[model samples]
Target: MNCEVYKGSRKEGAYLFVADSKSLENLPAALTEQLGDLEFVISFDLATRTSLASADPAEVMASIKTGGFYLQMPPGKDLETC
Candidate 1:
């Protein structure tokens, strides 16, 4: 699978993981483990605006300072064209 990491900005911060159907199931656990050391961390479905809306401000800020976050894209997404 191909993966792309999106670093957030102060005005609109988030980690967006886009994957094909085959890789979607594993995203949550993988993201959790990968982000384990971060503070005030949480994950939610990308399809819902409310989910992203609930992100903790403090956590987002911390993540921004700590090199931001990563988005795991499915294979064939071709991030270079995105």
Candidate 2:
């Protein structure tokens, strides 16, 4: 399956993947509002990838198939609490 990817302005390295280039229409208004302005990144084929930077390719594909979108977030940084 192929998908169009978009980067979130609110968070670094955060991405939203959709099955179709026009699939952004299906996203909730709240989500888009939270994600801020989305920057077009690159198109990708899920079948050709085994894994993404911080997301499982298969899982992302599955989500796209079922939910029409998948959000990829950056790895969490370790925090020290006193």
Top lDDT: which candidate number?
2
Write candidate 1's Cα lDDT for 26-66 as tens digits: 44564544433322234434333323344444443444344
Task: Name the best candidate (by TM-score).
Answer: 2
Quote model 2's TM-score. Answer: 0.84
Q: For candidate 2, lDDT tens digit of each residue in 1-82?
A: 9988998776666789998778998898877877788899999788999777877899999999998899876666311110
Q: After superposition, how far is residue 14 of candidate 2 from its true place, in Å?
A: 1.3
For residue 22, model 1's alpha carbon misses the true position, in angstroms, by: 29
Off by over 4 Å in 2: 77-82
